[model samples]
Target: MSAIEASPAQQATVRMAARALGRAGLVHAYGHCSLRLNHDYLLVCAPMPPGLIQREAGVVVPIRGELPDGVLGEVRIHQQIYARRNDVGAVARSMPPSVMSLSTAGITPVPRHGPGTYFAPSAPLWDDVQLVRSTPQAEGVAETLGHARAVVMRGNGAVVVGATLEEAVAFTWFLEDAARVECAIRAMRLENASAMSAEDAARRATTAGRVIERMWDYLSAGDLELNSSHA
Candidate 1:
């Protein structure tokens, strides 16, 4: 439990995470990300390009799904997790190339690689990844992501959960970056045999998780205004 205050700086950091996700090649207009606010509401992407996601200033909605009618249809994707998972405070979804490729191959994305493994992240694959398919799918994801920070959608995409918006966005960016690294490392290993040691990987994950957590704390403390509701 580090000091995570809500302030403008925290919001900006969350915004930067969306931009980073795009820069890391985790954007598609269809993908989305969200941050839970005080267990009552959340702030999320505004149906724009990953790069523009931050520029548009994310939309705010109830943690209990009190959004206005006719908003992004995929919004339910997030609702699924929030309604069922009590531990998470934020959520993110992405259709990154490597992840999609893995999903298509039916192989799934596991945390064999990651940005830093900070935030106590774990990248598990879900069976039915489509968020809007059924109300139950989201619940299933929420269940899998129970207390963890990340889950990659099988044959679909990826989702990252956190204790705050900053942590969620950090997880999103880092996961995409890690996916890229994993894809490259995997290719190289297949070609030859070069690789990073398990010890190094574990060390990085632990360090990365803690760093993300602190940065998230700083960001949330700044973006106190973006909170959808005090609840």
Candidate 2:
């Protein structure tokens, strides 16, 4: 009952993403994560909470088609993009507290903080967390992310995509970090807005990418047993 007919390596990446996001506190038990097996196909997690969703069984759904289970509405956004572009591989939807809270309050993450944060001068389709109402709405959203890392949903949360699960999870981590930094900076009302400039954010995106590769290694090794850590 697994979704999609993917290689063991691809499936392992899916499980790794679930565990890493749970550990990073992005998942709850209801949120969803998916990887594009190909432009017309993907592997979706079962319906459940963000942190607790399981892959033991899922509805292998295909684009240009429909499933009896009905897809998550939020997934419409990702599906729309995959239907149009072949560049994106993994997509995740989660309501991380900081990003959620910040979006509601109209706060912005300053990835300009350093080379570990993922924000930018050319990030795309996002300014103060623009929230699109439907899947087709994401078409405009993708236009903005033409080459940036991720995009935020105004007052909702975020949808992060990358070439691999590891890349996607890493973006999610820094997205949170950027949020954390913004929260702290605002609480203190510090005058270092320049701390979040564009140049620094791109640099950090690069560094964060490397850090995530190391994590991908640890995750792929099978020594961590991440599933039990959550149980």
Candidate 3:
């Protein structure tokens, strides 16, 4: 449903998704996310920083054209993807530190945790370090993304897409976890450090999708739920 037509609950879920991504360390103050409101439009958060996003902060806008005040300049990224990919329902752009680090280093993240299996064997890199503010740039990045779940923007961060909001959030979380593990391995200088095989990753992706809603429930509950689990 379009954000203009979304229920209070749906809009609230969108807000929660954004904040949860922030809490999971997938996004910082600068990045943005969007939900495909309908076939022709997406509901994107305002240009305000990530952690501060509220339910009312979203703006329903067309895929292209002069952006509304407070709309993100990089809404073009969300716009172009929604324009080109018929199956996509949600998109998230984040600047998680580890992911951005790997991007700058020209290293693609691989599955290190079981959740990491949700990603492709290697997330494609956009290579361009500029803000994705133009249609051609957005289309090129979307092309690099292809059918992959995620793509890394060199010197920027990563963008994840999904058939649903839950899946997008799941990918964002797993992407950062993979990056963290990759950085750890690199830090240790393991000459032959191995990542999960593509076959294993595919198998895990299937399993992860089945339980993604549960995982999202746990994650969205914040650290109190996590702390209680360890208590």
Candidate 4:
């Protein structure tokens, strides 16, 4: 396929990932998701709220160039990340409530639980609340992410990347769950709640036995498109 054209299955996967992020409460009206089509392009979902997207709605965007006419401005975040991280096949920009709430305190979730271990020591913090609309701003966000699976934007939400679209979706959920736990710990005043050791977190962070796939299946289970042949 050409860099500008995505097959039906690829388009369906992008739609499914967007909807899953929405249904899981990880995103709302302002978020977007994209999957890399190749080294040169990516397919981003329609600009509307993720949950409200329907049919084959996506635009193929070049990885290194001016944003396409109809693409959202912040999609530059995806473009920048795709340009820097060849390992990342998909990207999600989400506003999970707990993640946003925790980030406001200048904190990213600690590795205090099983799902949290995937992020290990902690997800990096962008320390910026501004929307990443410019190329420079998007580059800053992607640089903050580095080799991490996710990066929390202070009071702005988060950006998650994965080796595949499913892994990206699963990691988005995991990041939020970790933040939820962190919020609960703070609420209970458990300031001493111990975090998993780096050694232990590394051991537990493996993607063995369909760990990520299972989470993706659970999150996308109710999507009719994913259940159909298009999935």
Candidates 1 and 4 compared by lDDT, better number: 4
10 residues in a row with least lDDT, candidate 3: 222-231
**Model 2, 47-156: lDDT tens per residue?**
66644544554445675555335566556666665676577788777667777777775555655465235566523324544445464566666664565566666666
TM-score of 1: 0.68
For residue 203, model 1's alpha carbon misses the true position, in angstroms, by: 4.8
lDDT of every model, 2 decimals = 0.60, 0.62, 0.78, 0.91
Q: Compose the digit string of candidate 4's lDDT tens values, residues 120-215.
A: 899999998888879999999999999999999999999999998899999999999999999999899997899999999999998999999899
RMSD of each: 6.7, 4.5, 4.6, 1.6
Lowest summed lDDT across 10 adjacent residues in model 2 is found at: 222-231
Each candidate's number of clashing pairs is: 19, 19, 0, 0
Q: Show model 1 residue runs off by greater than 4 Å.
A: 1-15, 53-57, 84-87, 109-122, 129-133, 188-204, 208-210, 213-231
> Can you list the residue pairs that collide in candidate 3?
none
lDDT of 3 by residue, 3-92 (tens): 355444455656777777888777777887788878867777666776677545467777655566667778888888888899999998
Model 3 clashes, total count: 0
Model 4, C-alpha of 157: deviation from truth (Å): 0.5
Give lDDT: candidate 4, residue 153: 95
In candidate 3 the C-alpha lDDT for residue 44 amounts to 76
Q: After superposition, how far is residue 225 of candidate 1 from its true place, in Å?
A: 14
How many Å off is the CA of 63 in candidate 4? Answer: 0.3
Whole-model lDDT, model 1: 0.60
